[model samples]
Target: MTEEVNNSAPDNSRRNFIKTTALAAAGFMIVPRHVLGGKGFLAPSDRLQVAGIGVGGKGESDLTGVFSSGKSDIAFLCDVDDRRAANSVKRFPQAKYYKDYREMLDKDAKNIDAVVISTPDHNHAMQAMAAMQLGKHVYVQKPLTHDIYEARALTEAAKKYKVVTQMGNQGASGEGVRKLQDWLDAGLIGKVHTVYCWTNRPVWPQGIQWPATGGNIPPELDWDLWLGSAPYKPYVEKLVPFNWRGWWDYGTGAIGDMGCHLVEPPFRILGLDTPVSVECSVGSVYVDEFKRGYFPESCPPSSHVIMTFEKTNKTKGNLQMHWMDGGIKPERPEELLPNESFGDNGTLFIGTKGKMLCDTYGANPRLLPLTKNASDRTRPKAKRVPGDVEGHYTQWAEAAIAGYGKIELSSPFEIAGPLTETLLIANLAIRGIDVQRPNANGKGVSYPGRDMKLLWDKQNLRVTNFDEVNQFVKREYRQGWSLGV
Candidate 1:
């Protein structure tokens, strides 16, 4: 029900900048693998120079992981909030710092061989796109982007710009996903038809109204820049550092936060694509005993979303994928032992021949029925990243050094983007559940979009029968912000 339109960036100049930079970077500035052949031939100075945007929290950890790989130099850091960047700045004392990412990219484009982005969902597409347009390889934290259009655009841009790209769903690099694949391939699970992924997230507040009054902006934060692409609004307590996940403008809610981590396994195992249909049922909060409140601005407290994808060669029939979040979970599989624990964050796959379960990041995968044959069926046939999950960062850093397509990436945009689109498409149904219309007799409000299966036309990116929810497919950015698609 809310829309913001501000498309005022100078088109010609931006396109020219991207084109010129991409042509100049037809080859990587980072030393290729051949240049690092032997111990004596490669100097410490030959490491790829990586600049990090939004270097705090996960960003700090991502940068550390890259540097720890022993293949990259942490050359620059950028974040709008000085407070959040403090830990990363101290950690990388030699790295130059900038408050604005655009400033950082503008000044250091030539010096940086690659960039890592761990900003909030809203800023992800723009920052990553800008880095790619400048012909730098990129590593972005997952859910890829806030919207489906952004995901698709970033996917295509990675190929067009000829840059190495990785989304931070480190789970994609985990052995668990590989094990599940091996089990499936070994004919242990037959063919996967249904998947249930659940999480106890939105640990932050949701299903509430925005604050009616604005508070004083914090000294350490740049409010304007933090609201990049999102409509400008006055500051509110506890929105920064975290908690932005609940708001539609800044985040894609729980699914966005954890879908990349949990849903990724199924996407890879099943070889799924954009969902053909999505349906949802959400938990509601009551203002009083008699009244239930609908807060469209925020995500619901709990949701159970089901998405269907047409049959692929790997799937036996149409695939039915279920996503539950905000503490909701699927029924315990009967095959699971009564005494065994169902992980708070985990995935369950019900295949025609058998079943399998796993924990977050696709770790701890085990065949169901609490039987010995589950673990006995398969040995790994797939390649693994050296450090397993932690290797996700180094994989990208090494790939950046190796140049595009020289090395394989586990969660490159081509894969992660489509996976992200599935999650966001499910979100369309989640958000649509709250869509309001004039009640009969125009007395008040009614949820016209609830409890109905929503059909998706992937070709056009629309809700074929439900026009109201199509607005979310691609959001209108604030003035001066665009995906530059």
Candidate 2:
């Protein structure tokens, strides 16, 4: 499958009109606010009207978080599966419901001031691009996009459309990241050199084969629509609602599932960009006494990937980042005592001066050896989010109300895009391991992508040495679906 990147300029008449109208509304509000009510009063119309796509599970929680901020209203709810959307539908009965997000945006564009997307990985780019084309502020869930190309596109689209965009890596807004940043800035952990981020995910099934028999389609589910942008396939049992994470077509494997939450802090603290090179080795499942199971369609049970990044302002030299998943972890630092937990899922930053580690979402950060740490280490230096992690939702809503470029978001597309690309690049190495080709002698197969460091051409978005793996960079969408870049 091949994809052609669209480079034609997008029409901006609607965006310009919206900006003009907003300016006029601001002019009207400037004079009436003092006379209409006392200080700090907000009329109902002032509340941001938010539309939610994929309003189930994480989607439901995302809308709930925005609503709890008291600065937004759930104006519309959309989901492909009615059964999955029941709770959200009951909670926001007043909001319009739709099985198709395209129909929702088409009809209610004017009513919606923003869009919150918590869809499966494959659909994120298309859904977000559609909303942004209509000038809607978007808050996309973590990992941002399913592919490296899509992540880069959305990052650029956020700027092109002048939308207030935030990726749902809520940990970026937590006190722990700020604390970690402060330590780095204050030279507590001098110049971070090597970092390790690990997760025990695939808590769902992985390293398995696709079910041979297609399951009966549920009455409330639209299997075709659910496969948006992905190649059409029969409804596989248990792939919906969750288990899609392990599949190559619908999900981006464990790294895509948890890397955004795990790798985000080090990405931010170090201000890293695209990596220079990446290499990985994955664990194989056994099918018999001698042969190993080969299921290229799914992610491996475990993987240890190393990515090398050029020196950023925070580092003295090139940095190496190791990512391990499926219950894998790096060597425990000697300074850490035996009793203290190294955490099942966390990030460890090794610096010239000292070492610091934090749990998932950058929570519970601490320097090595609890006994030697000084009380002054926790001194406040970095700014804190109003409500820490929960504040991520409100910050985006308030920023949208304040208009583009008004307020800073912790995981805005500017930061999230590259961070996402970093993880996806690691995945490239993982997937490359499975790339099979006929041998030069035409008798057996050769896995050229294995046991070698894949050089990256960041500007071109391809693996320089291993061309076979580039196919995973930008996927070919199904008919009628386009990123429309």
The prediction achieving the highest TM-score against the true structure is 2
**Local error of candidate 1 at residue 380 (angstroms):** 1.5
RMSD value for candidate 2? 11.7
- Candidate 1 lDDT, 41-82, residue by residue in tens: 222346888899999999999999999999998999999999
**lDDT of candidate 2 over 194-267, digit per residue (tens):** 99999998788899988989989999999989999999999978888999999989899889999999999999
Deviation in Å, model 2, residue 305 alpha carbon? 0.3
Each prediction's TM-score against the native?
Answer: 0.90, 0.91
| TM-score of model number 1 | 0.90
Candidate 2 lDDT for residue 197: 92
Question: What value of lDDT does candidate 1 attain over all alpha carbons?
Answer: 0.88
| Alpha-carbon RMSD, each predicted model | 13.3, 11.7
How many collisions per candidate?
0, 0
